[model samples]
Target: MIFLKLFRESFLFAYDALRQNKLRTFLSLVGVTIGIFLIIFVFSAVDTLKNNLQKSVNKLGSNSIYIQKWPWVNNEDSPWWKYLQRPTPKLREFDELQKRSQTALAVSYEISIDNRIVKYQSHTVEGAQIDATSHDHDKTWNFDFEDGRYFTEMESRSGSPVTVIGHDIAADLFPDGGAVGKALKIMGRNVTVIGVFKKEGSDILGISDDKEILLSLNFAKNVIDVQNASYNPQIVVRGKNGLSDLEVESEVRGLMRSIRRLGPNNEDNFALNKTTILSNQLDIVFNVLTKVGGFIGLFSILVGGFGIANIMFVSVKERTNIIGIQKSLGSKNYFILLQFLIESIVLCVMGGLFGLGMVLAVAALVKAGTDVQIVLDIKNIIRGISYSIIIGMLSGIIPAYFAAKLDPVEAIRSN
Candidate 1:
């Protein structure tokens, strides 16, 4: 009952302080508000960007390995000419690995070609990303169709003039739906659309599935010079459910070495790259960003803590006579300390809430104006409040201690 009364009185005192000197209180807490805003905003943005990138990378494939002539990132230890001379993965190599690999659930290959124009009679859509893909490629991509079905294995092998259009292309060419079985001139060849990809909205990172069209490998070869090493045709393999990705990749690597006729003494010429490479790289970068953001926020928060401590000291000095009166009335030293501490904490909390509100407002504005999504999650909110409480307690400690230790006789005489 006593603690409750003390807390109530402290709350009123804190509220009255703010009410009496609104501008001064706001000015004092400005540091805390700015610091919290910076830290939370940065954390939220970095996390959202990381998630977006990971999602984009996932669209490439998960539990899937890419066998290519060149590594995803250039190797500093090896001569560039070594990789330059390596042969681009071929359909025959894909077939050999598919026949031999035990850990793989699906094996396929794809080659990206130059962007080309597509037309459906009068309606024309230009600069559509095209991929020439072999059998089981769609399985590796794991696309959920918006309309029609994936091309049959026979259609893929025989180099049938069929194309699977992305959502945007489908919309542009056949807005009324029923894009399947429609004859569209793609890259000067009339091909029937066999499948349409689901809608994936625009991304600032330029990673979107809605702008691509898939073609049969053989059909693409006939149209473009895919045999050129610069085209970078890659063989993709998916791991079995029970198998580890590394195990699948290892089996593929051994099969590839044998198929390439490389002896045990020779180094494996081709690179077996995983989609997780992009994710791992991005994680490292985000970790660095987190550290940088932390340090930058720390400096501002330190200043804010000092500002709060200064406010507590001034508040104690301003209310010294009140403290003496309470002590003379038989209030305990601990109670005086608790009251001042609670008051300081409440003030800090008010500032923290304002800071969080500002962040949420900016987050909403960003979401409304841009494709980038900034989320102020529950975890962040809790963290902000916790920081506020801790800072408040630390800042108030000295002032609360001094107020508690003051001699009631001297304090009352001075006032």
Candidate 2:
């Protein structure tokens, strides 16, 4: 009952003090509000970016591993320049790896032909990205077909003049008509359109997969008139179930080294890139950014805390005689302390709530404007509220203690 009475009296005193100086209270909260706003806003944006990046990486598949000329996540010391110095991995290397590895489920090689002009009837589209991949490309990449089927393994081996069109390419080439069974001229060579790919929405990198074309490995070589012997291929290996990615990667490296006949102390001439490594690197970058944002937001809370302390000091000076009168009326020292503490808490909470509101409003705006996903987790909100309360308690300590210890006779005589 005594605690309840103390709480009620504290609230009443806090309300009266705030009402007496509305503008001063507002000024005190501004620092906290700005600080919380920055912390919340930056965290929301970084969370969105991280989620998108993970999605993009997962699209490549967890079990699948890629072997290319350059590393996916390039480092300063070992740059693309290092990869450029090495010889390109040949398509034969993929065949050798597939033959040697018993742990792999499917292995394929891809070589892209860029800026190719695609034509059907009178319509022409330029700068099309065409990929020449093996029959396993569809199964390996989890590609979904729209209207027709992917090229058969026989067609890939026979180098059949067939093509699978991307959604955008089909729309551009056929326009009013469907693309199935149609012949489109690619780089002055006629190729029959066997399949059209369905649209897969933008990846985490904000890239659409709709603007690509796929062709059988041999057919692509013939269409581009590139020498099959000299062609550089990107090897994609999918490990069988229960086989670790590391094991598959190590096996592939060993096989490639043997095929290329690299000396024992020399590094392998090709680059191996994996999705997991890329995802981990991106995670580290986001974590650092979050910490930096939190520290910057801490400064705002500090300023608000100082303001609360200053305001309480001023209030104490202004209400000296009021304190003396309350003490003369038999008010306890604890009561005086409770009143000032409540005032500080109320101010800090108000600022926190306002900052939360602003963060939500901006987050909503960003979500509506873009496809980025920025979710406000319960934990983050809880942390913000807790931090505000801590700031209030710490800031109010000095003022509350000074008010409680004041000599009533001296306080009254000053007025």
Candidate 3:
């Protein structure tokens, strides 16, 4: 019955205090509101980026693996100035790996050059990339043809000067329609356009395949010959769905090692690219960002806690004579402590709820405007509330204890 009375008195005191200083209370919660807003917004934006990147990767087929001289995603420091010093992997080794590995569903190779000009009649566009690939390239890369058909294996092997244009290239060159069976000049070399491809959106890697033109590997080699044309082609491997990506990667590595006759202690000269691995790495990066955001937001909560502590201390100082009157009326020390503690908790909980509402409103706005998924899970709310209560307790402990232990005679005489 004493605890119930104390609880009611505490709530009444808190309500009266808030009603008397509404503007000050709102201003005190501003820090918390801004902190939660930043954390929630960053979380939603990063999640959106991750989802879009994963979707693009899935569109390329999850069971596919890419073999190249450089890492596929997030690779820096290529040191292209020392290209002569870099070791080149051989195409013969790929063939040997294909023969030895049963997990490989299909293998294809391609050569690429960036910023090649394509001209159709009077229209010309620069900065278009050229891809020289085998007939199996479409199947390996999941390329969808918009019109006409992919080049035949015979045409690829025979070094036919036929080309397939991406959607953007087609639109730019043949805006008036009828692009097929037309002659186009690629890098000053005349090639016949046989097909056009569908438009794929820009990816996280900044690659827009819709702006490229595809030709036979042999034809590309003849047009833009550098060195080791057959041995240094970019290799792509497709695996069956049931096969483990790790197993396929290991098998390919072992076979390449054997075919290249590398020494027992030599490091791998080639790189294997996997989309799932990149996705995991991206998750790790986001996890770190989230942790940093949490820590930064925690500072605002700490400030709010300090504000609660200061307010409780001032309340105790102002009500010293009232505390003396309550003590003389036979109120226990624990009753006094409970009143102050409950007051602090009330203020903190109100602030936390307000912050949470702000977070939800921002998340809703993000969802309505963008395709980003901003989930407001129970875990986040629970965490916020729990932290608020803990802060309240820690901040109120000293002030409550001081108010409870004050001598009635001294408190009444002093103020």
Candidate 4:
């Protein structure tokens, strides 16, 4: 009951102080408001960027691993010349990997050959990225359909003239007519469109969006030789949910060695790359950005904390006579301290809330104006409010203590 009474009295006193000197209160809180806004904005932006990057990387496949001639990141001990001289992984090696690997759930071969104009009667889509893959490609690439179904295993193996077009290609080549069940000319060979891929939003890395054309592996091989180093394909291997990536990688590594007839002493010529590596790189980048942002924000908050303390000191000085009268009326020292402390906390929290509102408004504005989706989640909101209350307590303690210690006679005599 005492705590509730003290709280009500303190809040009323704080409200009255604000009404008496509105400009002074506003000026004191300006620093805190700006400081919170900066810190929250920076963190919010970085998190949004990280989410975008992860989504982009995930489109490729999180559980998939790639076997390629060139390494994604080169080791200091390994010579670049040796990796260059290594033979490109071919259909024969893929066959060997498929037969030998036990942990692999799905295996696929894909190659991006060349860009070409896709023609359907009078419609032509220029500069569409032409891709060729085997039947299991869908498991690794994760295609969502807009029109029809993916090509079957038999069609891919028998060199069927079937294709699946992307959103942009379908719109361009078959604007008037339907894309599925229609014929289009790719690389001068007539191919039937079996499916149209759904529209996927733009990505940060600018890869795997919506401007691609997928065809059968055998058909692509007939057009361009797999022996050519320039047109080398990537072999993707995926493990089931229960399987560890390291186990899958180990199996693939051992199989590749057997296929290439590598001696025990020879270094690994082929590289096994995981999709998570891309996400890992992005995580490192965003972590550094968050730290830098936090460091810059801390300096501003220090200045704001001092500003709030000054405000509390001024409020205490203005109410010294009130403190003297209350003491003479038998008010306890702790009551005076609690009142000033609550008032300071209220002032700081109001400032913090204003800053949070500004941040939210800015994020909404950016999202509305741009293609980017800016977000400020609930966790960050809670963090901002907590910081505000803590800063308030730190700033108010000393002034509240001084108010509590003031001699009743001296405070009443103050001019």
- The top-ranked prediction according to TM-score is 1
* Cα shift from native, residue 179, model 1 (Å): 3.0
Clashing pairs in 1: none
Q: Rank by lDDT, descending?
A: 4, 1, 2, 3
lDDT per residue as tens, model 4, 1-415: 9898888887787788778888877787887787777778888988888777777657766667899998776558868888889878788988887787788888888888666788888878777788888888888777689999898988988989999988888888877748899888999999999998999867667766379899988888788875467766889998777887787888888989889989999988898888677677777887888788777665666677788788889989998998999899998998989989988888778878888999989987887887578768777778777777888889899999999999999999995
- lDDT measured at residue 170 in model 3 versus the true structure, 0 to 100: 92
Model 1 segments more than 4 A misplaced:
75-78, 175-178, 202-206
lDDT of 2 at 153: 76
Evaluated at residue 232, the lDDT of candidate 3 is: 55
Error of 3 at 193 (Å): 5.8
Candidate 4, poorest ten consecutive residues by summed lDDT:
294-303
- True-structure RMSD, every candidate: 2.2, 3.5, 5.6, 2.7
Tell me each candidate's TM-score: 0.93, 0.84, 0.69, 0.90
Worst 10 residues of 1 by lDDT: 200-209
Q: For model 3, how does the per-residue alpha-carbon lDDT over 1-415 read when each residue is reduced to its tens digit?
A: 9778777888888787778777766666565555555555456556656767776776665777777676655446665444445455555665676678777887777777777778988999898888877667776677677887888888988989899998999999999878899999987788998998877756664655689898888787676662354335677777767987787787777777777678999876767888787778888888888888778778888887877788889889888999998998888898899999998887777777787888778778766885345666566677777777787788788999999999988888867
**Tens digit of lDDT per residue, candidate 1, span 287-356?**
8887787677666666777887887888888889988998999989999999999988888888788888
State in Å the error of residue 89, model 1. 0.9
Query: Candidate 2: which stretches are off by over 4 Å?
Result: 1-22, 79-82, 119-125, 142-185, 189-207, 225-232, 325-330, 408-415
Candidate 2 accuracy as lDDT: 0.80
Q: Rate the local accuracy (lDDT) of all candidates.
A: 0.82, 0.80, 0.76, 0.83
